[model samples]
Target: MCNSNSLSPVWRELKRLQSTDELFEILSPQSFKWNIGKGTQILFWYDIWVGVSKLRDQFPALFRLSGKKNEHIADMVIFSENGLMWWDIGILFPLNEYEDLQYQMLMSLLRNFKVDLYKEDEVQWTHSLEKVSSVAEGVRVMVKSHIDFEFDRVKVVWNKLVPSKISTFHWLAIQGGIPVKEVLSYRNCLNNSSDDKCAWCLDHIESIDHILLHYSWSHKVWTGLFKWWNIFWVVPSNVLEFSVDWSNGMGIKAEKVWKLIGSATFWAIWLARNEVIFNGSYTCWAVIVSRIKLKVFQWLVNAKVCESFQLYVWSDHPWLLLQSPSFDMF
Candidate 1:
């Protein structure tokens, strides 16, 4: 009898401050005196206030029509509609993005027909409790898994649960409406797009392959490394082939050369495209080759490296193979 049970779990202690009955006004409506404690909860008591009859209808699951019936009702908190259970805080919150997630999850749980799965005529409330607990745990897991990839891409992305870390090249590829595989395919199918001439030949218009490896400029850029490292390679023409065989079948020096060459070629091509578009200037082959040479030389200096790598470099970019004429020992 919540009517007489004005022992509001929230605000009953303050009423004890005064002992006199005159301090409060008791307006009896069928049952339970009201207008107590400065008219607090009077409106709530007037509106949604139910005295057994309405409570039975509104929340039949909690209260059966006939107390002796011992049968479940429509508002049974024990019923699991999908995994959506009575314990879900999702039930009590406003519908927002996160709430939408809850809603969808609940709908999915309902769609699973999990409520009917249990043969027990006696309702089980475990689904509600378990679903809520599971969802809460998943949310925490996902949030903990989120990361900002500014520091170390490989370490950050491949830590444990997260692994799909992207790079600048990936970004550019996205901008071009292409994927990594497509870019590799373009590498292999570097056929002349213009006339009968080969783009790489500089004697003819270019294709993707010409731009990557076969062009006269690219050939020169790679020649130095090839001669130095003695890498024997069969050029590929698609993303899949290149990704698989780009650095395979090569000695340590040859592998290093392939890595450097691939990087230089991709970098040079991207730069050349930008130069052509933004500066309206055609990059000379000699300039491209020289840039590759200078970059390899500088890298060798900085790395103090004299070992093999997994990526590719051109043979002509033999800055690594050549002994440093002078080493500044500090």
Candidate 2:
């Protein structure tokens, strides 16, 4: 009960309460501050070293740590008129490195200003924001934390874009069952000089577009499907052009079909290419069409995939539905 002890009894209460939980009052949405500007009110969870001069001259009760070879046990060292003083700051935390460290550095930048569709946030929204770049990065990080996602499909593309190699999308694609090999090969498709030809159609080297869009076989599959659906058949020549030129001119049905067309078609063609190379076999165009139809229908059926099947629909043709990964789409 003597007032001789350095902390005015109240600080001791705070230190003791920390044994139970964090020093701040735990409110639902945010932490609460009970006092400020007063001698007792403090948001800091740890001690603030008042420096040697202030401690020795102002408060005779507080003790100092030995500053031997900078190996002092105190949490922090302070310089004052008397020279130096060491005081315990708080509990030391663990460490973070690399991308985690970069992320933290990036998050710190959010303090500047971030604009979403129509919203704004300040830098100190959370100290944790210090661990990310923009608010968008923060959101993506939170999403990664809450949900399990991988980026196997786009791994190659993303890795090429990411220096120091921290790939969020690559992980997501992997989790989505996207073939990493394809992602790696997708780059080859982007470069025209590469001999990477369509594995399904040996007549042309496989590039991403060649496999997905312009291959002789892929063209036939899509073209035939479009004709069946009574829609215009306008296939872009390469991935870049396709991205720029894709249209839903065939109406609502075409839009739905287009969504699934690329994925389903590519999946089908890739599977066939494997069959030819590994199995040493090839199917006629008519057989290929039937197989594709069967595959799409199975996917549709199994997905119980009703109204939104259009998300998978392309070219407005039931024929487009046939070209899926496996015959399981029914």
Global lDDT of each candidate: 0.37, 0.38
lDDT of 2 by residue, 186-298 (tens): 32333322223345654553445555567677678777666656667577554433432333334533443343434444456666766776798776655665565555455
TM-score winner among the candidates?
2
- Residue-level lDDT of model 1, residues 272-319, one tens digit each, is 655654687777766776676555545554555433341133225454
Q: Model 2: runs farther than 4 Å from truth? A: 1-203, 240-254, 303-330
**Model 2: per-residue Cα lDDT at residue 266:** 49
Off by over 4 Å in 1: 1-167, 170-210, 213-232, 252-257, 306-330
TM-score of each: 0.32, 0.33
